[model samples]
Target: MTDESESMETTNDESQKPESQGRMQILDHALSQARKKIISSAKLQLFQKHLRPIHKKNPEVLKRMHMQLTKQLDCHISEEVMLMFAEEQMEKILDDLDGVIASQKDNKEEAWRPSGDPQQDSRVYNISVKVKQKAQLQHVLSQLEQQNTLLRDHVALRQKKLLGTKRTVDSGISKWREINEAATSIPADELVEFVQKYGKIHRHHTMIPWDDDIDVLVNGSQKEAMSRALESLPEYTLYRPPLVQWKFFSKNITRSKRPFAWPYIDIFFFGENETHIWDKANRYTQLYMFRKADVFPLQNKPYQGSLQPVPCNSPRVLSRTYDPTLCTTSSYTHKEERSKDPGSRKTVKCESLYRKFPFVFRETRDHYVMETVKVGDCILYQTKAALPCWTESP
Candidate 1:
C-alpha cells in the first residue's frame, strides 16, 4: 500500500511540471517585451511586427493582445518585486563596500609585516623586529579608523548640501519657465525657435540638479533683434561675458559659479550652415554643431508644469556634446582650458567634477548609494554603514 501511494505522488508531480514550465515561459516573454518597450519605440515594434498577421486577420484580436501584454507588464511591478529589488541592491552595495574596506585593510596589514626570516636573525634583532611590527600594525589601524571617520563625515555633509541644492534647482526651473513665457513675443525671424539644451535634456524634463546654468539656443543671424527684445524684458539683466568673439547673451551670469545660487540661463546664438546649425558658445575653441533637421521641427515636452521646446532628436545632439549613450551614468566636463589654444578644449569626465566640486554632486552620489544599498532613504543607508567596524561586526 505504501509503494502504491508513492507512485501516485510521483505521477502527480510529473503532471505539474509542464504547467510550471509554461508559466515561466510566459513570464520570460512579458519581461522581454517590457524591457524592449522601455528602450525605444523601434525595438518595441520589432516584437510587435510578428503580430502583423493577426492584426490583418482581425484588428480586435490584435488590440486585445496588446492590452493583455500591457496589463501583464504593468502588473509585474508588484510590491513583492520591488522589495526583492531593494534587497538585491542592498546586498550588492554592502558587498562592494566590504570588498573595498577589506582590500585596504589587507594592504596595510601586509605593509606592516616584518621582512626576512626571524629564525635566521640574532635574538636582539628579533626583539627589535617584533617591536617594530607591533608599532606599524597599530599605526596602520589608526589610519584606517581616521579614513572611515572622514568617509562618514563626507557622506553626511554631502546629503545636507544635496537637499539644499535640489530646493534651489526647483525654484530656478520655475524662473526659467517664466523667462520662456516672457520672450514669446519675439518675432519668428529673430527667434527662429529656441529649445532646451545641455543639462536640460533629461527624460524627466528637469534640469541636471547640480548644474547652475540653463542653456538655450536661438538663430545667430538675428542677434541684434534678439538682444533688443531681451533688453526690453525689465525683470532680467542681460550680460555678455567680456573678451570673446562669440557674443552669447547671458541673463544674470554673475549669479552662477557659486554654491546654492539661483541658476542663470544662457541664450546662445547659433549660426546655420547648409545642413547644420552651429554655436560657438565655447569662445573660439570649437563650434558645437547639430543637424539642422534634428534641431528644427522642435517638439514640446512637459517641464515644470508647462510644455517647453526641446530638440526633436535630443539623443543626436546630446551624444555629440556629452557621452555617446542617451542616458546612463551622468558624465560631462563643465570646465574648459582657454589657455590650451583656439579650438583645443579638453573634456573631463564627471568623476573628476565630483572630486573638484564634491558638494554639487552630493545628490547624485546619494542616489547611487541608495541604489547600491537597496535602501529607499539615503539617511537610512548612511546610518546603517556609518561605523568603522560595520563590516567587521557581522
Candidate 2:
C-alpha cells in the first residue's frame, strides 16, 4: 500500500530536487570549466596535481588514473565526431581522437601510464574504452560482433546487387535491411515492458521548456536504486553517438548502418555521484546530473489527480508547434529507435513515449492531441490520438 507519510515525503522530496539540480549545475559547470582551463593551461600542473610519489608505489592506482584520463579524452573525441557528422566525419574523428589521446598521453602522469596495466595493452582496447563507459563499451562490442556476423551472413546475398565490389564490400550498407529487420521486430511495447519488469528505468523531463531540444531525465535516487532499477539487462548497451553524448542501444539491433538503426534511449540523470554510471563501455543517458529540485518546473502538474503516472509528451512538444521546416533544423528527433532486423516475424514494439509539457489531458476537435518522443531516441512528435481530448469536440 502507498504510505501516506511516504507519499508526503516523496512529494517533498520531488519538490526539492530541481533546486538542488540548479545549484549543482552551476557548480558543475564551474568545475568543468576549471578542469578544462587547468588541463589546457599546463600539462605539468595537471600531472603534478594528480600525480604523487605514493602513486609510483601504487602502480594499480596510477594505471587506473591513466585509464580514466584516456577515457575522458575519448569522450571528447566522440563529441567532435558528432559535431562533424556524416560527411568526412571520419577524418575529423581520427584527428580529434588522436589529438585528445595525445594530449592525454602527455598530460598522463608518467607514473600512472598503462604500460603498467597488465590486463589491457592494445590501442583498440584503449581507444574503445576511452570512448564509452563499461556498459556502453560492452554494448558497442556486441554491436560490433553483430555487425561482423551480419556482414558474413549477407555477403552472398549482397554481391549480385552491387555493380562493383564496393557496396557488397561495405557491410554497413549491405546489412542495413537485415539490421533494421532485427531491430523492428521487438515492438516498442515489449521494450517498455522489458524495462519496467527487468530494466533500470529512471524517468523525468526538463523544467523550462525551450524551443531547442526535448529533454527526458533519468536518474534513480541511490546506488541500489541505480543498479536494481537501471542495470539488470545486458541485452541493452550504453553508447556514445558520433562524438559526445551517451545513449543505450539494444544489442540485438546494433549492426545496422541505417541512421534509424542508431537506437538510443535518451536518459538524463540528476545531480552528482555520477561515478556509478560513467565507466567505459558503460552507458548513461545524460552527461550531467541534476537533483529533483533542478527539474521540478518540467514536472507535469498531476492532471486530474495523483493516481495517474507522468504523461508521455516530450518537453518541447508540450511547449511548441509542428513546423516541418523548423523541425528539420530543430535538432530534435522522434524516429523509430531500433529498426526491425530482417528475417524476423516478431511484432515491432513501441511505447507511448512523450513528455507532454503543460500536460493537460483534454479533448480536441476529434482526437486528443498528444506530444510524443521515441524511447531510445528522444524523437518527439505532436499528434492527436484515437482518444478524444474531451467528451465533446471543441
Candidate 3:
C-alpha cells in the first residue's frame, strides 16, 4: 500500500511540471514585447525632439513641401500627413547620426579656419557677416516693394473711379454763377486784374471749351484787405498753399473736384520793382519789364455775366507770356508738344532737381538761394550774404 501511494504522488508531480513550464514561457513572451514597445517609444520621442528645432527654423521648407504635394497629387493634404513624412525622414537621418556628426564637424572646421594674420581673418569674418546681413535686408526690401506695388495699384483704381465721372454742363454753369457771386464780395479797389481768362463768359477771346478754375490777380499792397473780404463771405473758405498764395473754394464743395472742376479762385499777387513786374509768391521772379505805354491798366471786363477788373493790355501780356497761335486756338493740344520740346529741357531739369533736393535750397522774397556748397556740385545761385549750411551725414 505504501509503494502504490508513492507512485500516485510521483505521477501527479510530473503532470504539474508541463503547466508550470507553459506559464513561464507566456511570462517571457510578455516581457519581450514590453521591452520592444518601450524602446520604440523612446526612439520616437528622440526623433520628435530633434525634428522640432528643424521645423521651427525652416518653416518655408514645410510650406513648399505642402504646396508641392497639393499640386502633384491634386488633393489637399492635412498637417498630420506632412508631419508624419517629416518624422520618417528624420528617423532615417538619425539612423546615420555618427556620419552626420562627422560631416558637420568637418564643415565647421573648414568654415572657421584661421589665417596666419589675425587681422585678415577678422576682416574676412566681418565681410561674411556683412554679406549675410545685406542679403537679409534685400529680402525685407523685396517684401516692402511688393506691398508698395499693391498699395499703388489700389490707389490707381480709386483715381480711375474718381476721374471717370463727368460733370454736367448745367452743373458747370451753376458753379460759375456761384464763383461770380463770390468774387463780387471783394471790393473793386482791392482787385488788380483777372488772369487765365479762357471761359465763354469773358470779353477776351475764349480758348478752352470747358471753363476751368478762375485765377485772379490782386494788388500786392491790398492782399491783406482782399483776404479779409474773401474770408468774411459765407460762400467760400480760404485755403493757403505754400509760398503765401491764397486759394478760395466754395464752402459746400467736396474735395473730389478740388482746384480743377470745383467753383474756386486762385489769387496771385504782383509787385512792381524798379524795372520789372515781379510775382510776389514766386520768389520775386521777373514776370515782365514792360514799356511805360504797354503797362497794364485796370479795366472792367465782362466775366461770368458780371463786370470784373482786368488788365487792359491782356492781349499784349498774353502774347509775351504764351504762344499767340496756340493760346488763341479753340482746339489745341500743346502739353505733349511742350514736354517733348528741347527748349524747356533745362527748366524741367532745374524743377526736377529743386523738387528732389528741396532742403538744399532756401526761398526768400528777393531770390531763391542755395544753402550748401560742394566741390563737384554746382551752386545755381550764389550771393555774397549767403552762408554754407552743410549737414553732416548721419
Listed per model in order, the count of residue pairs whose N, CA or C atoms clash below 3 Å is 2, 75, 0
List, residue by residue over 1-394, the lDDT tens digit for candidate 1.
1234535654554454334334334444444454434422322244347877776788667666665664565556544455774776744665666567667874644444444766645665778888999999999999999999999999999999999999877766666666666656565433433323544433333444444345667776766666676667666666654333223323544454532223345567777767877775566225477786666556554455456665656557666666732323323323321133434444555444433221111122321211121112232121111111111234
User: Across residues 1-394, which tens digit of lDDT does each residue of candidate 2 receive?
Assistant: 1234434544554454334244334433444454444333333334435787746577566656655664587468556544555565554565666567668875745543566556665674776777778778789899999999999879857765564666544543334333323333443211211111111111222211222222323332332333332334555554434333345445667455543234344433323342322211124223222232222222222211111112132222222323211111223333443333454322211123233333223234444435342334445333343332223244
Question: Where is model 2 more than 4 Å wrong at Cα?
Answer: 1-215, 220-224, 239-245, 255-261, 272-394
Model 1 CA deviation exceeding 4 Å by range? 1-174, 187-196, 241-262, 281-287, 324-394
Task: Write the number of the candidate with greater lDDT, choosing between 2 and 3.
Answer: 3
Lowest-scoring 10 consecutive residues by lDDT in candidate 3? 384-393
For model 3, the local distance difference test gives 0.50
Cα lDDT of candidate 1 equals 0.51
Q: What is candidate 2's TM-score against the reference?
A: 0.21
| lDDT score at residue 82, model 3, on the 0-100 scale | 44
Total backbone clashes of candidate 2, pairs 3 or more residues apart or in separate chains: 75
**Candidate 3 lDDT tens digits, 220-270:** 777666767667767668886657667777677666534422455667876
Candidate number that wins on TM-score, 2 or 3: 3
Top candidate by TM-score: 1
Q: What is the TM-score of each candidate against the true structure?
A: 0.37, 0.21, 0.35
